[model samples]
Target: MAVGSFFGSFDWSAFLNALILGVSIASIWLIAALGLTIIYGTAGVINMAHGEFIMLGAYSSYMLQNYVGLPFFLCVPAAFVIVALVGLILERGLIRYLYKRPLDTLLATFGVSLVLMQGVRLIFGSDPKYLAVPPIFTSNFQLGFVNISAFRVIVLGITIALVVALWALFYRTRFGVQVRAVMQDKEMAASFGINSDRVYMLTFAIGAGLAGIAGSLFGVLNIVLPTMGTGYVVQAFLVVVVGGGTLAGSVIAGGATGELQSVFAYFTNDTFARFMLYVLIVVFLRIRPQGLFAPSAKRR
Candidate 1:
């Protein structure tokens, strides 16, 4: 089909709806990628077990809501605390020792990923789990030509809140300064009495916590499974890479990719849309490998 003809036949209302859907999609990707961006951007650690952390978050929320009868809304933060603790333990026990050795860290985290996947499988079995939200969040709302889920709107609000909170945390806080100093020059940061080790530990924990929060939201969006993290992590990595491992980069990359994918999928099939998305990413990276927004020279 010719491009002009295709556009001529396109339903503008559907296109507008797709764009609105794109916002929700972007929020999802941004939430998932935010944690990874922090860890990799500041700490320079490519966390292979990130997906597992997300998985664990979903599981945490599930157990809390199912077994303890916790409210679904309250389970979100609970999941974060639980996963953050797990991340703390992993960083202190294993990740800390391997930071200087990037390749070893990668392999070790990959092993951790496997362990987490299997552990969840062993405990929860391979069956998919459902996360039930309140009735208010279960309905869809229509705005003009676009119809969207209430829960998705809530997720978008949460994502925006998180982005703002992170910005404040990274820029307006003393701890944030310490983290940025360590990222720019560890030796200099140390000379300035900044404990790089503690900074890294806190950063990793926060990252894991963010992933957990994302998992909780995702659980409601789709079925909760041990392997669900794998899918989100791929998109997270793409966002991080394309955004050049910056927080702003993640926001831009996630929004751009999510909208592009939705638009393409609207025009064609989902499978082909993904294929084209990947091809576009590849070509874009080839042309400007630095990403949409590159990190600072000192950080790099």
Candidate 2:
């Protein structure tokens, strides 16, 4: 009788709502982690400044939309281009020198992150900016019994498109083969006439561009500020770490972690839920430190 009452009293409607929202949450995390995964997986460099790259994207969109009078839709790609260019310059000027020095690279990127943050803060003056989306995106629509934001749906669609595009880029193209070869063995790739330096430069730029896209989308979802990237980056790092720094791993980990967090929050408060999720993650890492999809052993 006790067990029956406990089961019967469970809120099925809320559970369904949580599940729906969980997918949205997963999309956000996956998009945020995408660039980090690409950078770390390909270059073997942990970019501590990735959050700054995201911040730049949001600011890039803001400037193009507000000053240049560009449409919001156009601003997205423009942000990508602008940030990718910045990333390219950064790789050429600084990061290219620290390739195999993990500790030095980590510290150097951390310094770069601080510089970017302070520079943006000085220019933007800590004011929270906003990205104005279309009226349609600002509206709420029903998804079965749940009320869903049209913007969230759009974000989810965008995330899926990015994933598919990345998959095709990495799996179907000649450039993809070169990238994989370099990742597997830089010297072997060089022996095959592939320019490892060029590959690293391009991949880093693309990864940064992906971060820019995430920032552009995220700006509309939350207030745009220099510090905005910090929160998303934490989640991004969590996704990448748990995912084992692979594209597919990020997708899987993002979904699982988002769903688990949502379900936990449904039962408890958000604070407690996060606490529980962190505890679980610690336990999981303890059991499998290599993560869900560790890189191939071929890579030194």
Candidate 3:
């Protein structure tokens, strides 16, 4: 009891530290989860390769910055465009064929992920690619007792802004309505003359674009690696399951879950923290098996 009490003291520094770490990791999960949710929820295709798209996006930033010597700010959008195009090509060439069959789609994407990782390794030689952030982002600022990296703060701002913009895109725009329509009932919505194909393409592009955005910022946070996407895939899957496959819920839940894991890991060891994360997923699924935020099902 004494030891437990000692560990549980109301120390402001520990509390703030936990909060910062939580917010940081949770935001990462949020980004990864957003891309996964968009593709999975809208198309009902579980894209196992979604993380590789993010990996590619990060690589895109590195190539543009280190290879072409583009300004850091410019590399960001280039990453987005490159990954978005990849998503488009994958959707048009592969995913479009596997639409009605869900499991096959998963398997296909899994294969694609393997190929992508290997391709990245073959090209980049499995060495972590270095991406240097601009001086402005590398600087740090203090908020009361908390000192935060400017880069992290910038990433958080971008994540929040993207979330808001996505919500608006889906909730306020005609394209969003069409996407939601297809999600709720693809066949029926298609019968209504909504171009399901276009909707799928656009949604897929958006998901990929979000991934590119995440990777652009994420590359600055870590050395870009071939299998880096492996880390994000499971976390995003869990976020989709926990949050119920909605774009908004995935972002919120992924961030929340990441934050929780980080804080728990801070108090515990890495293995135990991962165990706790899985336990939360099992506990969450037992409560809402259909997912927390899936659109109304139109399955006949």
Give the number of the best model, judged by lDDT: 1
Cα RMSD of all models vs. native, in order, equals 1.4, 1.8, 1.7
For candidate 1, give the lDDT of residue 156. 98
Shift of residue 247 alpha carbon in model 1, Å: 0.5
Pairs of residues at least 3 apart in sequence or in different chains that clash in candidate 1: none
**Lowest-lDDT window of 10 residues in candidate 3?**
290-299
- Residue-level lDDT tens digits of model 1 in 170-268: 999999889888888888899999999999999999999999999998999999998988888788989999999889999999999999999999988
lDDT of 1: 0.92
TM-score of each: 0.97, 0.96, 0.94
Model 2: how far is 188 from its true place, Å?
Answer: 0.9
TM-score comparison, 1 vs 2, better candidate? 1
Candidate 3 displacement at residue 22 in angstroms:
1.3
Query: For model 2, what is the alpha-carbon lDDT of residue 110?
Result: 89
Q: Rank the candidates by TM-score, best first.
A: 1, 2, 3
Tens digits of per-residue lDDT, candidate 2, 1-300, equal: 588897887988879999988999899989999998988889988888889999999999999999998989999889899989988998999999999796787789889989999999998889899999989999999866898899999989999999999999999999999999998888989999999999999999999999999889998999889888888777888899899988999999999988998899987778898799888988999998988999784833
The candidate scoring highest on TM-score is 1
lDDT: the better of candidates 1 and 3: 1
Estimate the TM-score for candidate 2: 0.96
What does the lDDT read for residue 82 in candidate 2?
91
